[model samples]
Target: MSDILHVATRKGLVSFKRAGNEWRANAPAFIGQPVSAVLADARDGTLYAALRLGHFGVKLHRSDDAGASWSEIAAPAFPTVETPDDNAPAVDMIWTLVAGGADEPGVLWAGTTPGGLFKSSDCGATWSLNDSLWNLPERKDWAGGGYDLPGIHSVLVDPRDAKSLTVGVSTGGVWPSADGGGSWRLTGTGLRAEYMPPDLVFDLKMQDVHRLSACAAAPDIVWCQHHNGMFRSIDGGETYSEITGVKPSVFGFAVAAHPSDPNTAWFVPAIKDELRIPVDAELVVTQTSDGGKTFASQSDGLPAVSYDLVYRHGLAVDRTGSRLAMGSTTGNLWTSDDSGRRWTQIHGHLPPIAEVAFG
Candidate 1:
């Protein structure tokens, strides 16, 4: 069987497949619509794509035979406004989609802009709002990072326990739930909010998490690429410890954990928040085989000088711990089949990519 990679972009969704020792990317799907997120579910090999249309609103598309064809599903929608004073938030973007556990078939989770979490028990055919998280008082204080509304960009569900999971928000900090989507509690004791004053940096409901990745083998081990620095949660995000020693810079958008080993992971470094481009305008993928103690920059076949900025969902590592794929805002796509020791640019000149997945 060939290893296939799916890329979600501002323009559409694209698929890349391996051919012998090389790879090739297919034409874009969902043309014209900004595909915010995509998931190639491993449990049943189902494909789900989230799109943002300027005219109609948010949409979710699904494909059973990979990307050969797709059909639209019932996208997550907010409850009808009960009264004129109702504070219902509109859905802006479907930031992330995650498949449920092995025991929970047809279960899928969606994280959206305005910080709404929804779950669909029948693949992507329907969705139900998670009011348990939406009614929290802290939701009102959560502000926007890149857009006018806060978004739940990273939803890390434990493959072992579908009911227990963690989600990353731009200005809302990290929220983990123990009883599926029934209820959630927020935590930021270890992570910092550098954008605020020193005294207010550690205040509740104040965190900017760009990306979050948890080990599949050990769900208790969580790795996060925060807005201020890199962090690892040893107790399933109950608390995080900052890895201040990450060379170059830990302020980045993407983080990928090893499928089995909880110690090894990958990160794509960018300049500080002020300069979102690659550090020194040079593109590199830093990896740490020994946790976050030290990282080695991998630029074997990557661009020499680049200014592309990879979004939070752009980096993905396959199950075997062999294939890695990432797409940047500059429309460049790169993949590595040997644990990221080397790389190959398989596609370029596509739209600003949003997310990457493999199946």
Candidate 2:
């Protein structure tokens, strides 16, 4: 089980430390500022926090000694392309941040709004835009989901191969790169997009993947919580197979995969895309231990009549695959000690959670 849990909220970034069985919150950091994303790198015990200040712009901070101290670092910035008529796209938010593989220390990968990927080889001292993915001609057809421009929120680095990466884009589809970010190919074969036209329903680039999680022990098994429904990929996201007929509704933004068990995964379901709330005002978590063949609704400690919603980054499972943490848009936080069988509400009155992670 993890001893530390970090939550990025609409107001600030909160950290919690587990003492024996009870988790205690530390003095909140960056209060009164909206933390867009938080990353606790297990590689070197480094913590990275991204703050989205309305008028001050986006800022990135790093804490080498846990949360005791922090220093401002260079946030990912888009290259200046001074075309006479075209304005270079600015990075509005760092949607997702992940450290490189175990062997590659001081390396980081960041996915940003306006649909761009960045790489840092010097521990975020500087960043360079991936021109291969950014200059792709197909990007012209990409559209946004929640934001005005398409954003890459999920970046999965193959545990076995640091160069192999898969990213899930909203309003865009699944993109896999075998030689790191040097080249890219759009996948997501069996995914369906009901929001698109009949002819474009199966278009790989038209599908909206809410989030993507792959089992660390079984890297080939990838789970996708898509805008249309839930999907699973057995071959490392090269292709996908939609899992349908789920209880409640299949519309949700978050999905957390067991770290060791490929067949075991968790999903927080909502009514649908039109109604982003619990099914019939009940917030329940659906778990599948046998791939997606069967699902069990685990809500022993959840609210019976609630209106909380979990975002794509709101659900997370620790390295043990036994400890899980979930946060909601309604300021509710819960943790499960035995997978998803039951949950214990930690905080019900925190700021609206944007992301949660266990370190």
Candidate 3:
């Protein structure tokens, strides 16, 4: 069987297949404006994508034929609107979508751009606002300017329990729902919140997490790539310990856990500053064979010198744990078939990419 890769691009959704050593790009999956998120449900082989139009609110698209074609679904309305701005009503853009409920194959959970959690009961055909999270008092404090509260960048559903879920807000920190979004609590104990002053205890911004991946073998085990460095949580994010140590430039955007090994994972470390110079940039994918105790640079096949910036939402690893792919804002997609130790530019002719996913 061929491995299919889904890429969310500025132009539209693109699908590619790995045939031998070459990646052949297929026709655009969604037409019109750019796509914000593209995901493939492993439980039912259904494809879900979110489109971001200029002022026309976000739209959800789904493809049952594995990106061969797509159809638009009626977008769900955001529950709370303070005042109707002169502009168009801001629709919550879905950032991440995951298949939920083993008994109900079509049930899907989605995280939104405004950092709200949602659910789709009819297999991505329609969705409803999850008030359990959207109506929280803390939801009003989410910031949305820059690397801040852009949306729910990461959403993790427990593999063992369908009722448990965790989501990461760009600046708001991590929130956990034990009863499937009915009640939520801030799980940012060890995370660094930037709002807190430097001298304060447990500043929120110390670990502005962008991506979260739970170990398949150990559900309580999770890894995070924060704005500062990398972190690992053995107790399902209750607390975390910095694993990157004193690396001069330890800023990264994405993290991927090994499919079968909870202690092994990979991450793409970018240049620390905005200068975009590679002299100080690591430009390497770091790996930890024994969890996050120690990480070694895995740059055998990656660029030796480049200023490509890997965004916070762009790195992903396949279920087989053999392939790793990361999309760059510089409009290039890098793939590694040998567990991130080696990589190659599979596709780079498209517009700047926002996110990438493999199933």
Candidate 4:
């Protein structure tokens, strides 16, 4: 069996495989416009990708034989009235796609750009709007600034219990659902809303959590990377506490959890100011072995003090927990097989990468 890596770039969905010590890129699977997100089902090896076109709206594609070929599927239509003025606003775009259920298959979920949750039953053929999250009473007050707006960047499904799930947004904080998408609640406690006064009750623009990962051993444990700092939740998404104490920049876009050890996780830190550059201007990966109580830098083979920017959707760990891979906005793909202690540049020269996943 061959190991495949699916990446979403400005060109389209591309596939890569390991050949000895080098990585080789395959032909473009879906070639039309840029793909926002690409995911492979661990259960069946089915590849699903989200394509965003300038005038064609959002399109979902699926491939059964890996990324060798693909077919387009129709998206769910929002409810409408006979009157022309009652038309629903177009879906901004899909930013993330996640597969659920490891045993009894046939479940998929997606999050959109304007920050809406969606579900699909017949694989990736069609979808339905999850209004339970988008229409929540608290959504009316959500706010954004600069390039940070309300868009779902991460969606985590509990391996222990398929019904429980968590979703993270850019400036909208994190939302959790106990019984799937039937009901939802805001679980942004201990997260500082940057736009509000320190003494205010609930600041709508605070806690811009970009990445969230679940612990494999302890399903309730989760690690999150925010615009301001890093946090860990012991009791699922109910609460979180600061983890990084080195006065690090605390402004990064990606985080990943160890496949076997729930307490071990990784995060990339960048400068936190409006300039949005790397602090100390170096590319490094930090790891916490004792859940988020402490953290240490692990950059034996990474770039030393350069201006490479790792996007929020680029960091991922394989199922075996042996290899760690991440892509940068500067068009370089780096991989570390030694649990992030050392690194290597596997593939570069591709267009700007939006998201990456290992299969």
Q: Which should have the higher lDDT, number 1 or number 2?
A: 2
Q: Report the Cα lDDT for residue 261, model 1.
A: 90
- Give the Cα error of residue 162 in candidate 2, in Å: 0.3
CA lDDT scores, all candidates in order: 0.86, 0.92, 0.74, 0.76
- Between candidates 1 and 4, the one scoring higher on lDDT is 1
- Give lDDT tens digits, candidate 4, residues 1-359: 22677778877777788888877889876565788888888888888888887788888888888777788876534545466563344566778888876744868888776677888877877778888988887775555522434777778888887788888877777888888889987886877645456674345235678788887767777888877678888889788877657445566888898877988998888887565656787778888888777778877877776676777778888877878888877767788888888898876676777778997
What C-alpha lDDT does candidate 1 achieve relative to the native structure?
0.86
Candidate 1 residues 222-335, lDDT tens each? 898888889988888989889887667787989999888988899998888688898888888889888778889998999888988888888888888888988999989998
Indicate the TM-score of model 4.
0.92
* Residue pairs clashing, model 3: 192-204, 192-205, 192-206, 192-207, 193-203, 193-204, 193-205, 194-204, 194-205, 263-291
Q: For model 4, give the 10-residue run with minimal summed lDDT.
A: 140-149
lDDT of predicted model 3: 0.74
- All candidates: CA RMSD in angstroms? 1.5, 1.1, 2.6, 2.4
Candidates in order, TM-scores: namely 0.96, 0.98, 0.91, 0.92
Off by over 4 Å in 4: 81-87, 145-149, 200-205
lDDT of 4: 0.76
Off by over 4 Å in 3: 80-89, 145-150, 193-196, 199-207, 246-248, 276-282
lDDT of 1 at 64: 93
The positional error of residue 272 in candidate 1, measured at the CA in angstroms, is: 1.6
Give model 3's TM-score versus the native structure: 0.91
* Superposition-based RMSD of candidate 1 using all C-alpha atoms, in angstroms: 1.5
The number of clashing residue pairs in each candidate reads 0, 0, 10, 2
